[model samples]
Target chain A: MIEARGLTKRYGDLVAVNDVSFEVGSGEVVGFLGPNGAGKTTTMRILTGFVPATDGTAKIAGHDIFEDPLAARRAIGYLPETPPLYPEMDVAHYLTYVARLKDVPRGRRKGAVDRAMERCGLADVRRRVIGSLSKGYRQRVGLAQAIVHDPAVLILDEPTVGLDPIQIREIRGLIAGLADSQEGGTGHTVILSTHILAEVEAICRRVMLINAGRKVLDGPLAELTRDGQRLEDVFTRVTLSDQAEASAGGTAEAAEAAQ
Target chain B: MRHVGAIAGRELRSMFVSPVAYAILTLFAIVAGFFFLASVLGFDAQVAEAQQFRAFDYLRQLNLNDHVIAPFYGIMWIVLLFLVPGITMGLFASEKTNGTQELLMTSPITIWELVIGKFLAASLFVLLLVGMVGIFTGILFFFGDPELPKAASGLLGLTLVALSYVAVGSFASSVTRNQLIAFFLSLVLLLILWMLSIVADLGAGGGAIASDGLVSRSMRWLSSADRFEQMVRGLVDTKDLAYFGFMIGTFLILTKASIESVRWR
Candidate 1:
């Protein structure tokens, strides 16, 4: 479970994320859609406790992210846009280090790493150095690290960005299985951020569209689209209209402030 | 703490695997060996001259601490000043450059744990270098009558100085993602701190007592080499110990603050 209220991040005068708020129930697979600079990554970073929000409160499974960062961080398994890997380290060694970082008990570290590797389909290349792996394998390693600790919430930023179509399908299926099979098992709340709309259709249960650091649409995937209007059409209409309005409003505010 | 150990263990492994570790070790050994041999030959030359005047008493009068080991330790410290930056430049800078800092920042580990872990790992590399150079010192036991207490104190002093270097170098790395910039920043900071005593001495030109004023005294007290000199003299003054401890703690805190600033930024 995750909750964010009035989240705002300002880098000097530029507002990277402004008054953004969202929520997801336990075990929900939510897709976060946004244009380049739509504050998706910023919001995720704040939630993961990697960056501080200028104003707002975020609670991760009941622990406040800002006030109780260690506990909140302990509940989050975050995979940033980059895989965050050491090139010289082998896959298993890297995962074991992550297990230690996530505070997996000594007795269960190997089991946790093994299960993560198994779930991510990375057992065959366990001994191979991460640098020697292909991009697809590297991405799988990123996914394995995120699930190594079995955290309550998983925030994956563009999990399928560089993978091929087959790899993408496999990752989507893996995510789908994680959401469905874990209904009675370990309930993992996943927030996936991606630019690809079709990927969301394939795996996400709910979609939230954001533009210019503001959430433009939030609802069930089916509810957001009309009887005949395609999702792409809706995405363009909402995002493009917001972009025009933002440019016009921004110029007016700047002129007024200068005067 | 266990968290510190886990982080430290990974850091040490990564360091050992890098080419930089081997390069630093080999370079330090070669340079240290050069200095050691030169000191021994220079001492041997002196002993030969003294034996002509007093053949029986000359060997007994040879002061191994002053003639050979002290100067060898001095050269070792200088070697460390250059090699230490290499060891520490990538500690935090490479992590940030490669984007692994995000994983570290989001983990349950605190900034202090990360800073201390990396610092301790760098210190361990310094220890390994000392251990390798210790083989050269061990040779003194067979041919010369070196004072064991003095030799032990000198190694302790060298370790303390290496730790101070690591602390500052870690802070330098934390402030920037560019390894070259980190290396130069640490080098410049160290040179300035070491040179302060020299500058103070120059200020008291022709004066017998260099500690003539508060500014000079403070500069001498702040000089890392000055404290090391005392330790080399087998005088482990509380003030000198406190100075090394304070230097290490101050730089570590500064490093933590820089990392925290990145999150806030």
Candidate 2:
């Protein structure tokens, strides 16, 4: 449902994301694993149409994100690194506003907001102001807004970050429930970006590991630990290998440019 | 455009809920009321002086449009220059600061649509402010006779001026995440535009070439104050109308570009 081809993003001389590519199938729960500044968020942002890739193409639900952004955006439910919320708006109103922005038909706008609220367990505090809500509730509101439009693909960046254990569990269950419910229907495609190995184990079946803006490994979770090596062991090995390789590569390029 | 409406509604709702909107409204009302009352009293004193001199011709000079409404509109224009930056300082800056810009940018709504929606929402709030101040004008209807069409035209001119202020302010806000920076940037730009015509006339460059010197003429054409003065005279010239339309459209396009450029960065 989501595909990226040779995606790269640069800020002036700083290459934020190097040539990278990945895909997520419909109804599949994929974990995007990367270290800090590993271009995980940039990749997700490209897929969600938040930022244009410096080079390469990203398509969401078969629509080119750059060429046909509106259609592509319509298929994506994105929870950015920070939840985009107006502090003064209450939870219910915020959802409704997002519903409207997502082009939820006027007749179905109310229903969509209500359903999203219920699914995210935000119904009890629907009337409460978002600014005053706890971090957990705010995260849930962010999740609720993303799914409010009923997009086919969900791109969440650190959805469970900063939450307490219970809140984290609830959010995880909510994500798992989304996939399970997909089994009986057309299903949803989820690409969750996180550094937590446990989060990947909890809900994600497939893991796409990235290092230094490069896709170092992508496979089913089962295959990654086939030789009795733990996921953490695999993560450290793949990421550190790139860290070493990147530094070596950087020096060579610098020497070549100097010469 | 339902997309535009949805964005506008949400923006206006957010603004009204914030204390900033109330602060601007209350402060504007107090300043405007003081000026309006002063204008009215000045007109009254002039009328008394004319009557004591038994000069019927002097009464003509006390026309409400000129003596009272015109100056009141001028005061409101200056008030807008100060007050309007508050309305737009947070338009795009807050979104960027609070990280909501990502959500907004990722949404299906186009950049132009978002800019237009924000500009319109701020314009609507300014309209509401003018409508509140129009209450003082209502006093004219009750106790005295003010030319209705002229008064209405002055209000239209004020709205246009406010729209221009909002247009500039919106563009300024799009360039930064700090509201104070946005406010000052807009204030400086508006001040420059406001003073251009006067500055031109005061210099040798103004009249050195001809009465229609390029520097002075161009400055006058760009000066919102100059156009608004013509509008208060109840002369709706197409050139004046086009000046405002072009000013607003230009700034809105720049604002859209400023926002689209963020994705690149």
Clashing pairs in 1: none
TM-score of each: 0.96, 0.96
Q: TM-score for candidate 1, please give it.
A: 0.96
RMSD of 1: 2.1
- Tens digit per residue, CA lDDT, model 2, B210-260: 547787778877898878988888878888778889999999999999988
lDDT of 1 by residue, A1-259 (tens): 8999999999999899999898999989999998999999999999998889999989999999978999999999999999999999999999999999999999999999999999999999999999999998998899888889999999999999989999988888877777765536856899999999999988887999888788988988878765777778888989999999989999999999999
Local lDDT at A23 for model 2: 81
The candidate 2 chain A region of ten consecutive residues with least summed lDDT is A179-188
Interface RMSD of 2: 0.9
Instruction: Give the share of true interchain contacts found in each model.
Output: 0.93, 0.91
Fnat measured on candidate 1: 0.93
